[model samples]
Target chain A: MQTKRMTFPGKWLPFALLAPQVIITLIFFIWPAGQALYQSLLREDAFGLRTTFVGLENFVRLFRDGAYLNSLSVTVVFAVGTTLLSMTVALLMASTVNRMIRSRSTYTTLLVWPYAIAPALAGVLWWFIFNPSIGIVPYMLEMVGYRWNHRNSGSDAMLLVILAAAWKQISYNFLFFLAGLQSIPQSLLEAASIDGASPFKRFWTIVFPLLSPTTFFLMVVNVVYAMFDTFGIIHTTTQGGPAQSTNILVYKVYADGFVGLNLGSSAAQSVILMVIVVVLTVIQFRFIERRVNY
Target chain B: MVENRPWANFFAHTVLIIGVALVIFPVYIALVASTQAPGDLLRGTMPLLPGSHGIENYKLMWQSGVSTANSPPAAKMLWNSFVMAMAITVGKLSISLLSAFAIVYFRFRFRMFFFWLIFVTLMLPVEVRIIPTFQVVADLKMLNSFAGLSIPLIASATATFLFRQFFMTIPEEMLEAARVDGAGPLKFFKDILLPLSVTNIAALFVIMFIYGWNQYLWPLLITTDPNYTTIVMGIQRMTAEENPQWHLVMAAVVMAALPPVLVILFMQRLFVKGLTETEK
Candidate 1:
C-alpha cells in the first residue's frame, strides 16, 4: 500500500474530529471494562462494599465451584451449538435465495424479519409455543401422544435456548451470506457449469471457497453473539433454571453480580468469559484468516 | 450443458418457499396470538385467524399497568421506548459520523490505534461489562433516568467503524475541491462530506435505532423504577411476579416488537444497503 502524504491541516483535523468518540468510549467503555477488572480483584463485604483485595481467590473459587463449572459447560455448548446450526442454515438459505431468479428481495426481506424481532420477544414467542398447557406446539405434541417438556429438564431448556438463539441469528447470517454470494463473479460459476460440473459440484468447488471469507466472518460474529447476546432469552425463559442446567457464563455473571450481589464472583466470571472470547477470537483470526482469500 | 432446466428450477423454488415459510412462521404465530383473548389463549383454542379481541387485548394490556397508578400504560411504555431509542439514535449517529469523518478525512498519529481500539469494543458484549456499567450509572446517580439508559450506548464502535469505512469511500477530490474553494475543515465536512454520506447515515440510523430499541439487559438493570421501564423491561416485569399474566405479557411483547418490525419493513432497502456498505 502506498502511504499518502497529508497536509498540515489534514494532519490535525482528524484527531480533533475523533476526540469526542475517543473521550466517550474511554469514559463509558474502557472505563467500565477497567472497573470490571479492578472489581474482580477486590472482595466485597456483605453490605455490597469492597473491603480488601483477594487476588486470584475469586478465580480459585470459580474453578472449585460446581455451578460455575456447569454454567461454563452450558455456555460452551450453547455458543457452539447455536453458531453451527445458525451458520449452516444461513448458508443454505443464502444459497437458495441466490439461486432464485425472482422475488429475491421479497424472500430476503421476509427471512430477515426475524432479526428485527427483539430477542426478548423471540423468547416470549418461543415460550408461548412451548408452554406445556397452552402452547400450541407442545399441546399438539401431547395430543399426538408425545411428551414434550422444556421446563422440566436441563437439556430441553438448553435445546429451547439454542433454537431461539439460532432463529434470531439466521437473518443476520443470511443477509451477510447473500451479500457475499452476490459479490462472486457470474463468469466463474458459468465457466464451471460449462465444464460439465453439476450445480452441487460447482457450489462445493467454486462458490463455497469464494464464500469462505464471509462464512468465517459470520462464524466469529455468530459465536460472539451466542456467547453474549442470548442472555435476554435465557433470563426470560429459563432464568438458568431446571437445577441450573441452562445457566451460562454470562447469566451466571449477571446472577452473581446483580441478583446474587456477589460482585467479586461475577467480576471473576466476567474476566474468565473475556479471556475465553479473546482466545477463541485470536485462534479464529489466525487459522481462518489464512483460509479466507480476501 | 443444461441452460434452463424447468424441473430443477421448480424444485429449487419449492424448497426455498418452504424455507421462507419456516423462517416466518413463529412471527406469524406471535401476531395471531396477540389478537386473541386471554380465555382463548389459555385454552389454546385460538384459531389461526384474526380474533375479535384485538381491542380487548389492547385494553387489558393498557389496564394491566402499562398506564396508570396500578400499572404503567402500554402507550406510555411505547413512548418511553420511542424517547430512549430516538435519543440513543441521534447521539450514536452524530458521534459516529463525527468520529468516522475525523478518522477518514484527517490524518493523525495513533489514528490506526484508535480505530483498532474502537473496533475491539465491538467484540466486548454488554454481558462482560454490565456489572461495571451498573456501578457507573449508580455512581453517576443516573439510575432510573433516560440519560443513563441512552448515554452508555451512544458511542457504538460498530457504527463508528462502519461510518469510518463509508467515509473513506468518499472521493478525496471533493474535500480537496471544497478546501481549495476556501472552505475550512468544518465547512468541508458539512458542505461536502455530510451531504454525500446521506445514504450511509440513513442506513446506520435505522440499524442503530433497532439496536437501541431491542436493548434489554442494560435498560432492565439501570431503570429500577417502573416509571422508567422501557417496553422490554415492562414485558419482563409483566412476567416477573407470581401468577404472571400471559395474555398481557404477550400483548406487551407484541407492542415492544412492533417498532423494529415496522422500521425494517419500510426500510428494507436501506437495511440491506447498510449491511452491504458496512461489509465493504
Candidate 2:
C-alpha cells in the first residue's frame, strides 16, 4: 500500500489505469475459480441433464475413491523424488563450481541453458533416449543385466517421468544453488580449513548449515514446481500411464475432467489443488518475510 | 588456497564435467537423432554420431510436417508461436506497467483491494482450474485465436509486483522536477518514467518471452486448429502418433527450442538479473 508522497491527482485516470489488469484477472482467473468452487458442490446425472445440489458429496466421494488416494500418494512421491534428485545434483555441481577462480562462468553457461528447454520437449527427448528397443539407456541397461521398459512396467514409467522432470529442473536449481553458494563468506570456509578440518568437514559444519535458507526456499519451490508445472513432462512422457502410475494430481484434474468427463469429481479435485497451492504460496511468502528479518 | 589439494581439484573438475555432460546429453541426442535417417534408427540402438539426413529432415519438418500426424508444417507453427509469445509478453508488460504506475504513483481508494485481488492470482495456476477456465473461454468464443492463447495467461501478480518494486527504487526527485516544470502525470509517465524503465523492461521481456514461448498446457487446451498449433504443442502431437516419426519429431523439437535458447544465451545477464529480481 506504500506510494509516493506527492500523489497524482486524478478522478477517473487511476481507475482507468487499473482497469485492464483487474478486468483480465476477473474474467480469466477469479471467475473461473469461483465456477470451479461452485461446480464442486453440484452433481449431474449421467445424461448431463439433471443437476442436484450435493454439498460436500463430491469431496466425500473423492476421499473414498481409490484412484484419488493413489494420485495423492503418487504426487508426493514424484514431488519428493524430483526435489531430492535435482537439488542434490544441483548442490553438488554448484558447490564445486563455486570453487573455481576461472572457467566458472564457462561451466555455468554449459549447465544453465537447459533451463530454457520446454518441459514437454525435455520429456520427449528423454522418452526417446529410454525407448525400450532403440534407446541408448535401455540398451545400456541390457548390457548391465537389467531389463528396462516403461510401456508395461508401472515403476519404470514412474522413473522415466521423474528423470525427464528432474533433468530440466537441475539447471534452475543449479543457478539458485550457485547463487546461494556465492553469498557464503569465504572467510568462514578459510577459518574452518585453518582449524585443521577437512574440506568435507568444513562444508558440513559451516557451508551447508549457512545455506539452509536457500535450501529450504528451493525445497518449497521445487515441490510447487513438481506438483503443478510438471504437467507437460508427465503428459508428454508417461501420460500418467502404465496404469495410472504417473498421474500426479494436476494431470489427474485435467484427465478426469476432460477425458473422463467426471465434472463434479474433477471440480472437487481442482478445488483441492487450489487449496494446496494456496498453502504452499503462504508458506513461501511467510518464509520470505522471516528471511528478510534475519 | 586450502593446503594445495591437487587430487581434490581434479576430483571437482571430474564431477563438474560429468554433470555438465549429463545436462547436455538429451539435447545432444535430439540433435543427433534429427540428423539420422529412419533406417538409421531402426538398428538396435541410436547412433551417437550425426547422420547424413540432417538437412533433409530439417527441411521436411520446416516445410511439411509428418503426414499421418496432421500437424501443420513447422514454419506455420513457429510463426504462430512467435506471434503468441510476443502478444503475451507485450500484453503482460503493458498492462502490468500501467497498473504498477497507478498503484505506486497515486493515492487511490480501493488500491489495497485491487492489489490483493491480483495477489490471489499467484495462487491459482491455469493448470488447476483447467476445465472451468476452458468453459469461460469457450463461452467468450475466444478459443483457437491468438487472443485466447495469450490473454487468460497474462493476468498475474508477478510482473506487476516486479514493476512496482522497480518503480520504488526510482528517485522521487525526477517526479518533483517534472511537476515543478508543469508536466502532467501522463506526460511524466511517458517521457521520464518510460525512458528510465528501458533496461528493466528489456530484462523482463527476455524472461517473459521464454515463459510465454514455453507454455504448453493452456495452449493445448484452447488451440485445436492446425493453424493455431504452436511448435511446442505440435511436437507433442507428432510423438503421440502410433509410430512416431522420431527423425521429424526431433527436428521439430530443435526448431521449437532454438529461439528461446538463443535468447537466453544472448541475453543471459538480463535473464539472470530479471529472474533473480522477480523471484525475490
List model 1 lDDT by residue over B84-181, tens digit each: 99999999888888887767666667878888777767656777888987887799899999999898888777688677666666666776677678
Which stretches of candidate 1 lie above 4 Å from their native place?
A1-4, A7-16, A46-50, A280-293, B44-46, B62-71, B107-113
- Model 2: runs farther than 4 Å from truth? B1-3
In candidate 1 the C-alpha lDDT for residue B169 amounts to 65
Which docking band does candidate 1 fall into? medium
True contacts kept of each: 0.57, 0.80
Question: What shift in Å separates residue A284 of candidate 2 from its native position after superposition?
Answer: 0.3
lDDT agreement of model 1 with the native: 0.79
Candidate 1 colliding pairs: B65-B71, B65-B72, B66-B72, B66-B73, B66-B74, B67-B72, B67-B73
